[model samples]
Target chain A: MTFTINAEISQFQGKLYKLSHESTSTKTPMDVNVFVPPSSNSKIPVLVYLSGLTCTPNNATEKSFLQYFATKYGFAVVFPDTSPRGAKIEGEDDSWDFGTGAGFYVDATTDPWSKNYNMYSYVHDELPKALAKEFLQLDFENISITGHSMGGFGALSGFLKNPGKYRSVSAFAPISNPSTCQWGEKNFTNYLGNNKEDWYKYDPTHLIADYKHENQPKILIHQGSKDGFYYKDHQLQPEIFVKAAEESGYKGGVDLRVAEGYDHSYFFISSFIEDHAKHHAKYLGLIE
Target chain B: MTFTINAEISQFQGKLYKLSHESTSTKTPMDVNVFVPPSSNSKIPVLVYLSGLTCTPNNATEKSFLQYFATKYGFAVVFPDTSPRGAKIEGEDDSWDFGTGAGFYVDATTDPWSKNYNMYSYVHDELPKALAKEFLQLDFENISITGHSMGGFGALSGFLKNPGKYRSVSAFAPISNPSTCQWGEKNFTNYLGNNKEDWYKYDPTHLIADYKHENQPKILIHQGSKDGFYYKDHQLQPEIFVKAAEESGYKGGVDLRVAEGYDHSYFFISSFIEDHAKHHAKYLGLIE
Candidate 1:
């Protein structure tokens, strides 16, 4: 998986490298942006950020205000595209939420989607391996994972499913119980062949209920109080995951903070990015 | 001069208000975004930002990273659109560099353009007056001005032409000697006719040559060393303006800092936004 440097932009005391590489899992060319902090002599810790729906690598790279924090903590941040591009499947570009830009971080079991919608294995398995082999300056072993919305679900599920793979995990307005949410129900049914059992494997609440951490693993989450998805539709049932965690082996490990007056936008993510960066920095050992 | 609130977003400790208003100067509806700091009992000082060509109010509002600084300094930042929209001129929107987004902050004196290209008066006079009347909390009287590229030229010319209007002025990769540059020459010829005297009135170098600042006026500027415009094309000759200031009435007033390995993109602006914010904060009396 040889990566091509699309652009190397000077941002803060670092360089934002936009890279594209052919993926084995999705069997398509994937675009990812990595921000490498300046004045680094050795391999640095990495933070993989999965973006939400309808986003390319450029959305979070431009709006998340993560470069400042990445430079401050000497950590590299990788922003992967939400889904595969130019895949001319029958219903790929049908809707904004269903196919294109909505990979849902799942290895699809169904026919049409199974061919290309392997984002879970792509992001968790193929991407890190490719990045580690390509960029020698990034320490993929000491990495933290985070995301927003559907990508938030990706981070939580990825961290939970592959324990000990990521040192720390956090999310911004993640869909906690994807098995029950409308967005999850639609994508899972299409991607996983309407199998509830397969959907539960990817749900954060169900995964956390069975999985246990050796050192009482802590997961950080921030949900906006005024988020339209949280309040108006009640699709993101964060409290359900909190309740499930409290009753399971991962009891008292979830730290869910509801920020006041923030909506589901990058404006909300940027305001609280400092805290999230510090949280990851502490676990990544960049800060005491 | 009636204003309509397009959107109000909470960012950091301020509210970013996207507004559209009918402009008397341009005789068109203009879009502007204002970030007002939180918990201000009295009117707060304003920092007006003029964007470069090919930018609307949304560019800086989303990418400039100025809201954090606005909240930190307790000052309101105003981002005004670069040019009038949907005017339907013969050659408007023909080229990205010339027509629709390239008002050049000048009130056109020619036949076709004179009908709507009145950005100078719109930004300097009409916008502030309307904002003051509508939002009584913004102290337009005590304001600072800054911009990037062509907008940088706008800030310098606007400040120099109207003495005592702005408390401080700064620019990033500004087209300083607009009369001598291709971009400046083209816009000046179209907006103000081919009169060299009219072009001189809007040129920062010529304006600063004669105008005497009362309080040892310090104009801060940051030009990227690797900026393609500055190095390759030699279009943004910032040094000429520096030399002009050194020999003119504004001697010792211009502080032009050349940043190493930076480009003329928002990445450069976001990198040094904190310093620019602090500079404006000092002159706005928000910080010592």
Candidate 2:
């Protein structure tokens, strides 16, 4: 078996399968959780959920409350781990923000990290292919992407870069303009080198500016007003992506909602998960 | 403030307040998380959730998906920690089954444990009083109690002993005949001494046998058939209580639904949470 079933838990009207498989991109075993709705038959649209920094497949799998929505909409939800596990690189486990659990969803171009920190290809390409091959019921073509924080940035940047690849994109408190953020600057400097151009390639704000939508490409985003990362540190500037979208061909396509009293946590994500699910369901043609 | 608000995150018309407070029962600062549902104007009913072994308050707070139901029903939910934390007893953290996270919800009568392991008093009395005094909007008088595994035993034992105290009681994969179960017998011997009578007092099977119904008390329980603890170890003898209920005045009052393909994890609890919430809501008079 290419994928190992670590645990299978029955939840809602579905079963949550915790799986691990050797990844060619990361060159290590990666853990991922896939929730298949109970009544799912034939081909079901996939909704890939990416987690934030200092998270694993379990964080969103346990916290996001996605299974209920998945079961309701008849879509398979996949939770991919944030980064490669047990890489053993120097200073990897030192900080909660930069290394280990914080992959930032970029294919690292620097040494040590470059060898195993290829979460971009792992999540964007390898994971979907692996899942499709393993589970024939999953429709990768009709997939939608959604995430929180760094994972949220992954969804936006991955969606913008690969046009028409995903049916829809949604995020919760995403690091919109990652190139300028402290988290991004440190991670980019370490993983993608000092080249600002490399960082721009992965920045959602930058990507949205050049993105040419076939129709007015609608991207949904819910940011918590009380998010410490957004308000205190000014790390997650969601308005930048909204502004970029306005200037681009996708003008007025972004639906950025600022949720009051919410924070940069799973509580905030779980609150708006149903709305995001509905948004993706509409785009995936699960709902009209 | 004796009770420090560690983090307050907004979710689904509610705010999850992670609080740590000085405990009079446990004699240790205890951590708790309370979910105050949105749009609550008048004093609303409360649901106190007790987690199982090797769990913190965050387990159910994150995974149980109770907040949605609480918000829907206009009720507040409180998730108390499994046990007194950081007690630092000699053999406290030695085993996953006892000590540390597994306080077993007992007011210990032995040795070092007796000093800090008074979880029964902490959860049933002090915690509720503290929460009621602290949050004006919470009506502890109208509170329902529910738990899973060891905490489920807590709910049954607590509810049975304190007649007319709670509006209702429910459990998921609870150790019904804990006095006979190894997990129960071991913890009982350690906490309540070697007296079998002392252990029986805390056992639901024994309690239900002698329980005097006030207008016919009803208790809802959902036990998973695939639960390893129930099948393999025989640690959770739910049938014993059901049999006892059949002989007692609480006959047909104990609704024990054996769910298929579900385990003893939060997944099982979350799967039936809506049903449990509705069950609680009916007794709490939040629903018709």
Candidate 3:
């Protein structure tokens, strides 16, 4: 069945389009929201934004700083739900870590979740195909992928694992060495089973250490100095990935920005969003 | 009783201070949200944003195209809720145009509302006083006011009545001749009684026609050509106010800009907000 999109304008000075679609791969319907640039022209570049754990499509659509950039660069933004929802299947009601809100942006192979939790294919394929059919101005060819925390891990793993899929990639305080972090350790162990190699494939730091992507895109990483979860003192060390980028000869070497007196909040994301937009805009050739 | 405030950071890249104030004037506590510029010093000029009908402090704080301007011009923004909430007093549950959500930015003189509907005093004096005590850097001496629809009316009426108060003023599709619009008629009749004389005191066009300020601050007006409420054919015309400003011999002339293909939504506000902030910044000496 086709999704009906509700069109409305926000006081934020942007167009809000809400649509729902049945995923062929996931076997479950998903809700998605897209914010197009203020421009009347429809063929604008797009940014695929993934959200973190305990978040749905509504989180980033309602809170992220991508719109201002989209409004400025005349780009469109597509936000997909973290996992398939509304089904009464088994294990869907489990803890917040490995269940509904945590699709891990990968195609699940196990039961219960495997029935509908194919977020990787949903975000990369189904939604884009639906968006292009509905909106005339969306440029799928110049799309970039980005997210925060778990979503950041998804973006890094998804982009590195499939090098030519996205124009560029970046994240804010993502689980860099996810295989080593507790949150990542728990999720990876469940989602991919006890396969350590499968875990490294989704780990950004591990990908950096191994080195992939002959045509590397600019990577912008923004981390708050005061972020309680992954500060320099915390278990989630971003520098290890920075070091990995240095040693592995990664293309478009990391531009790690340390924001002072900031934390792991949208305020931190919004503060440096313009820089990320500019980075993507430059690589996508949307702006000079 | 004192209101409690907690400082939280927004993903929009700014510091958010949530304020709850005991409105001594009304005996009912009020909740307001403020977003400050990315400046270390608090001595920045302030812009008091008044939202339209059916809105709260959260609307502008969450949506407005303010961050770009706030960051660029280094101005703090104070967003007060449209009206007082919680008490189930008489007429409080009236239509959407009056009572609870629609404070009209005026002090209700009649029954039921008079006790808690003192938005005029709250915005003009108490809110600023609270912000001043809490945020040290806000320069009240160099403050400006702006809004949308009813809030726009509030800005114009507030600035016009309190001449020499704001260095500048502007609005997005304001109800210029509110004395005749349906929204104004409904709000003013209930809040100000059936007396046209009382309504004139809150009407911008009427206020400007009665008394002119010598150093009239730069008044920037942006009205969409396709505004659903105030098109060229409608009663909510911007021309009447523009003509009144021109013929009334006001010192500071109005800068009326008609945006093509825009409406009364935030998309219109976001598109031109930076320009408005720049206008205020130039007069307040925040940016060269």
What fnat does each of the candidate structures reach?
0.62, 0.91, 0.44
* Tens digits of lDDT, candidate 1, B58-161: 99988999998899889999999999998888898888878799999999999899999999999999999999998898899999999999999999999999
Ranking according to TM-score, highest score first: 1, 2, 3
- lDDT by residue (tens digit), candidate 3, A68-107: 7877777788777888777677766678877778888877
CAPRI-style grade of the A/B interface in model 3: acceptable
Mind giving the per-residue lDDT tens digits that candidate 2 earns over B1-288?
567999888888888999999999988899999999985457789999999999999999999999999998888999999988888789999989999999999899999799999999999999999988889888898989999999899999888888878888999999899889899988999999999999888898998788785735578999998999998999998889888888886843788899988998878988899998998888888888
Q: Compute the lDDT of residue B89 as modeled in candidate 2.
A: 87
Better candidate number, 1 or 2, judged by TM-score: 1
Candidate 1 regions exceeding 4 Å error are A249-252, B249-252
Q: lDDT tens string, model 1, A120-239?
A: 999999999898987888999999999999999999999989978898899999999989888989899999977699899999999988887663457889998989999988778999
TM-score of candidate 2 chain B vs. the reference: 0.97
**Runs with alpha carbons beyond 4 Å of true place in candidate 2:** B87-89
In candidate 1, how many Å is residue B94 off? 0.7
Model 1: lDDT of residue B10:
83
Interface RMSD for each predicted structure: 0.8, 0.9, 4.5
lDDT of 1 at A188: 90
Better of 1 and 2 by DockQ: 2
List per-prediction Cα lDDT, in the order shown. 0.90, 0.90, 0.78
TM-score of each: 0.98, 0.95, 0.88
